[model samples]
Target: MSATTRPSWTWTIEPPDGWLVVPSTATEPADAVRAWESEVVEALLESFLPEGATGPDAPDPDADHVATVRGSLTQTVGSLVTFADEAATEGARAMAGVGLLDRGPVPVLVTVGMGDPDESDDVFMTVLGAKGGNPVSPPSIEYPDLPDGDGIKVSRVDIDEATGGAWVSVAAGRRTEFPDGVVDTALVWRSQDLVLVPTILDAIVDLLPAVKIIRSTV
Candidate 1:
């Protein structure tokens, strides 16, 4: 699609290298994934309608939406990782998908859920409140211009005590004129080893800039 053509779907970011995709399994986060699938379909179908067109004028986008959502689920479901035990899981799971990175000695679970109808900062607050943790840095970080969207907002916090890892939850999303547009989120974490934090943070920073929006013209 050309730059002028708006994306019918949303966006995705490249996970850091060495981070292998998790294999598909009947896991705890399946419910969250399914919810995301439903949201994606709904959003895509809404996008299919012409600017002012709605109701009968615009053909039902369900068939196309279903096909797209199913394709997305089949392609990415197995790769998702989740940290449900985390205090933020309750909120994070409600917004987007979650997943695990198995490349390091310890598996780092993160919330891969992004592009909820709400702003990233709003989502972050909800997640932080649900998790009930101390602020790691400032409550948020602002990026004036992200790759695809208008701007980006991120909220982060350090989890008080997580198993054997240094845990942090980050909720972020890109901005758009449409209030209903999708925003993204990532819960970043690494082994308690101080040395690993820098590398992990660097990877997270790299991944955020790589996020791309794939628009559907169908």
Candidate 2:
């Protein structure tokens, strides 16, 4: 596809990479970035696979939405990691299909499940990138446009978002050094994206306050 010829599908170009992903974009607010990523993943899943082939067998979806629509959903949530692993598995399969894993673009897999408190600063999240299914070796580094004190801990996970699958990149700077004592939750920020399950949707609806926009019928 040529840049001059805009495809029917939405296309965004990355700085030096081949494609620019929405979740990987730098402008989104940190608070809701992960949620936004989940939303896009769900939509992609819906776009692919047969109606009944999604749900439990598909990528993890938001819990809040699940409860309300579960009864009517064609798919089910087999387990918590269903969504996370599914996304990775799909990405690998895609790379393989195109014969690219070894020589093609590297695959990035992220778990939106739960951020590991051990490595991150908060309970909210910490984004992680796995290349070819393993934690990205030598973690990536992303620098600030202007000289800043410290840069984000990782680099972007570059992957083409395929149906039902998400593309994640590693970034540098989410990690901060602790001299020797326990640190407070205040230390952590959204940059360290943890794996978020579809269950998070329920958390959002129940207590997690967020500005929600409803769709309108034109």
Candidate 3:
């Protein structure tokens, strides 16, 4: 396996540009992927908890539930076991990093989890959709740009009514041919606050049609 594997990326939106893309290279691909999973879960829990509700000094059951959910999401993503060669590893490296795109007070947390097809299948579900007997309700939002398949899924969760903050996540799958077989790719986005849900949704819808993935041997 290549020691420093990284994938190239192309964005769909420009005016809404300036997303600071970060590659997960702090450690090996597998370790990096795990680290990202932990961070994403933390961000999610932060979004769900009431404002000023958490502190290292206090214990909260709600916070515990959020933590459990994070673990679940990580396990779900990690369960992808049959992805294309090195794709998971390489893509995970591409998934790391943060970009702050401010649209007035609403904050958008953009996450990338593309891994090499030759590696592991962990991040595959995020884009290519998941394979199993599990079923989820259809999304309230329509993503016309997303291709239909088990690899792509979208949903919205209303977290807090008092503050009106909601969470929206998009798992888009892409396919690229490799010498071994066809490989899949995926990306995820989570909104920080209530006022930003619609904005994030719109941005994702507009950006989906423009995302491009390519496999290289050079």
Model 2, span 1-62: residue lDDT tens: 45565312111212222211223223435455456445534553453334755566544655
Scored by TM-score, the top model is 1
RMSD of each: 17.5, 19.6, 12.7
Clashes of each: 8, 37, 29
lDDT of 1 by residue, 122-199 (tens): 554454233344656655555545555544334454545645344544434434333445544444443334444444
Assess the local accuracy of residue 179 in candidate 3 as a C-alpha lDDT between 0 and 100.
Answer: 47
Q: Give the true-structure RMSD of model 2.
A: 19.6
Q: Estimate each model's TM-score.
A: 0.41, 0.20, 0.36
Q: On TM-score, who's better, 1 or 2?
A: 1
Give, for candidate 1, the lowest lDDT window spanning 10 residues. 94-103
Tens-digit per-residue lDDT, 11-51, candidate 3: 32222353322323333375765675566556544554566
TM-score, model 3 to reference:
0.36
